[model samples]
Target: PWSSRYGRRNRYGPSPTVKVATPRDIRAFFMESESMPRSDYLSFPNRDTIDDTIADMQALAEQVLLKVDKTIEDQIPPPTAVLEDELPLHYDGLELTNGVTTVFMFSFPDMDIILPQVDIYGWTPDVMSSGVFDISSGNAVAWEDENLRVGLWLHSGWNQTAKMLQQYLELNDARYRREVWTMDEFLETNVIGSKVFIQQYDSFRNAKIVAAVRVPPEGVYAVASHVMDLATYLEETYPGHGFEKIIDRSDVLMIYFCGRQLTGEKAHPDLPTAQQSRFIIALVPEGS
Candidate 1:
């Protein structure tokens, strides 16, 4: 059971009725009404002069609209420079004890936007007590990998962010889609086998992927391990749920779990400690 600061309430005992306008009265009122102009119309000097003035005003309006568009575009930091300088990294010797390397990639569109930071919590009880692996560790690369994996699993919804951003930019500039790509599709197609790519949607038509390596859970070996198990369980127990199998071996496995744990020996539900979790693992074809 989950609890929140705000909860819904329902009142059952309510009885009140009031009569207002009848259908006959409403129909008679509308039948006697007449259509009228909202305001008095002003007459222009001459047809020729009115046409000339209208054309001039139209040109001025177009210029003003263009200037506003340029001003908004200027505020968004350009992605061309950031993408050129920061490329994805690949590692070889740094392997986790579980034999699987977790890779994470984060994308940022502009310098003004703040990217999400990562925090790693181990399965051990002593891990949190020492405060060693919390969010504020100087090891950004390590934390980034962990948090990126967690983000991929926890924030797994249909690519609404990409779609909303696309619609917004296209409203002002018709050429937006040619440069902008969906973040979900970009990660799914590009970094499938090598790393986990996670990113945020921004106002501009640009994106970035920050990459790092992570360690998998105790028994999990490859990215496909947990996914395969979950798929099998769903198929066997709840076949009616229509959970599909992983068609492409290149697809990554992202998982998120939320639960509560008992503190010490007390098992009170109201006082239990809450836990939130996320993990991402990449899977490649057997030969690849």
Candidate 2:
């Protein structure tokens, strides 16, 4: 694991050890139904069933991991050094076969359409320019933290959104052979590499993208953000929840819907808890 001592000062205390999901774990997602095959689940599942499918994929991953030969050390070496506030770009690549062909697609979210967001109307300059940007660019599924709770906002429809992304990638996989990337990439530089990584991830699931937020000076704790569009939608959705307003939808700023639900046993379920409360995500090409 890339230690926190390598990055910015630990005023937040020891950085929580975030468990990164491996490529195999991601591959396991596409392997949910042998009858349907990998692409079948990755590209065609409906939203209503996406979450259940994601769970099924996770369960299968656990089984696959249980059979791994742990005694055999990984051939990949860990990073000896890294840029400040950057995660060691370590990776373990796996050939995610569609059981037939491995391809990738790159479309939608024209970069020309996404420009840097400058000052907002009345707020301090901090909101537009503080902390690392877009923590979850290519995250097809939410990750779990050390607390065994989820790491990103997930509600009834987000899983469907995730599956939609998976399907979107499969739709254009006809051009590539394989993919490679790490889920921990954001731990190093949260904002800069997002768009490009997501582009590749969507093309081939090369990177392990997930909902990411930084740590507070007080240290790691659970938090959530509801970056959504439409006034009526927000009014209807957050009827009884307690959350602060981060941003209002505008032509310049795009909003993504993200939030957390209380699990019976867990205290904090939000992933990548950080100092910054708002997580600036990359351009989402598709969603629910």
Candidate 3:
């Protein structure tokens, strides 16, 4: 089981309920909390690069939003510069490709464990895969080999994490048409072939979008290993409740996301550590 300070709860007594704030809420907090150090690392594009894409899809009555990965700080050095098509890597080596997927967002302040929340809209397949549909012509097309994507939310006490986890499971079940597991299932099946766990530049900023449209079997195995590790950690840290009934229902397969492993500590001095954090739950396609 993975051990960390995050696992050990209040040693003195039962902790208070932590109010998990939304990204919009966090953005608001950042605006108000002058004392809180500004996250200089949070970068926004100057122009709306996807305006045309948005306009083209507007006829479909869809709202356009930006997908951001909080782990960018761990990937690139100071003055992070990534091309629009670039995909950043997650700590688990899943490449942050361009597609719709669910994400978990959380905040931790002064031991206030702001548990993760499901953000289905933050990055959904239909929304993330821009240019795939032509609203004007009312036609849908498959995405090219090269594409990239990004995106998450919050909840309470120890039950907070559980609740959020449940929400994520439910949302994923409804949205995605595939088998998803929480990690335990991978171990049970022994399908996790390759494991890559090292503290390095495993952030979104460092990842490049997958040049290929379809991920091969090797790619699937690499991601499954990380998913398995996360599941084991979650199971050990928060045992019982059958891990929101997701892990118990797993087939041990995995879906790959933004991660391309890099080596060594490429820490940025200006960026404040722990600005925001996220946990990912993915859908594993079988026959990997």
Candidate 4:
């Protein structure tokens, strides 16, 4: 969409810097599970299609396993047992209540600790970053673009991480309840009012907060520059973890893992200044 309005004058300069994830890359994820010691076959579902299972033993003799993240490996939950006899016919052999999938998590400074699989009550938005994974297909469950395939999902997922940011709002409103907003109208209302709207999304603080907005090609820079500034602020506020804007699509969806209710504390001290008002207001649930 940005390309259409601006005639695609290399909006962000060269091609998108964010590398899209591919199906092959997703398939390789299985290798990590394969190397893990399994107590039973069900622990690692879909075993028959593993590369090692179909590869010649001689050819694999000299190969070594890729290193897995020790933190994730150590924290992987054990399989839960299900009593099939006690279940109804439709539910037979289906571990509906107990299924496991790997998700990415991030730790940030001045942020509460997040435990993805362990926090069953959803009291805290413990998982800072993660994507829905399709266990049966061994692929990421996300939006797909013709050119990027699964990469669109990965890029969009990353782009959406702004939802987790701790925002400092000088003003608030009740009207930002929609899932999508036009960039021009959003800026006209919230930015001009110096307001950030996100109060009605979910009563629970830990619920996932997602918002999207569409910007015309001509006005793309108006929003993008502020977003990049926020990205920079995020990097400065939280060390080690930083935001990357690799996608320049007109419709942008942002996701935030709500930690406690929205707080008055500024994510960074410099936010909401006269020039940064748009940046601060844009971080609300109304998108863009």
List RMSD in Å for every model shown: 25.2, 22.6, 21.3, 23.6
Question: Which tens-of-lDDT digit does each residue in 26-145 have in candidate 2?
Answer: 233222211222211122122222234766667545544543424443322212222245432211221111111222222334221221211111111121122111121121122222
TM-score of 1: 0.22
Model 2, runs deviating above 4 Å? 1-159, 164-191, 196-288
For candidate 3, write residues 1-288 as lDDT tens digits.
111100112123355222222223323322232123433221211121212345445522321121123355422222112223323332234333222232322221211212322211121122212322211111111111111111112221112223333322212233321232332342222212222111223332111111111122223322223322434433454454133333443322122221111112232333232121122332222222
User: CA lDDT of 96 in candidate 1?
Assistant: 18
TM-score of decoy 2: 0.19
Better of 1 and 3 by TM-score: 1
TM per candidate comes to 0.22, 0.19, 0.19, 0.18
Full-model lDDT for every candidate: 0.24, 0.24, 0.25, 0.23
TM-score of 4: 0.18
Q: Is candidate 3 or 4 superior in lDDT?
A: 3
Best by TM-score: 1
By TM-score, the better pick of 1 and 2 is 1
The all-Cα superposition gives candidate 3 an RMSD in Å to the true structure of 21.3
Q: How accurate locally is residue 260 in candidate 4, as Cα lDDT from 0 to 100?
A: 14
RMSD of 2: 22.6
Model 1 is weakest, by summed lDDT over 10 consecutive residues, at 1-10
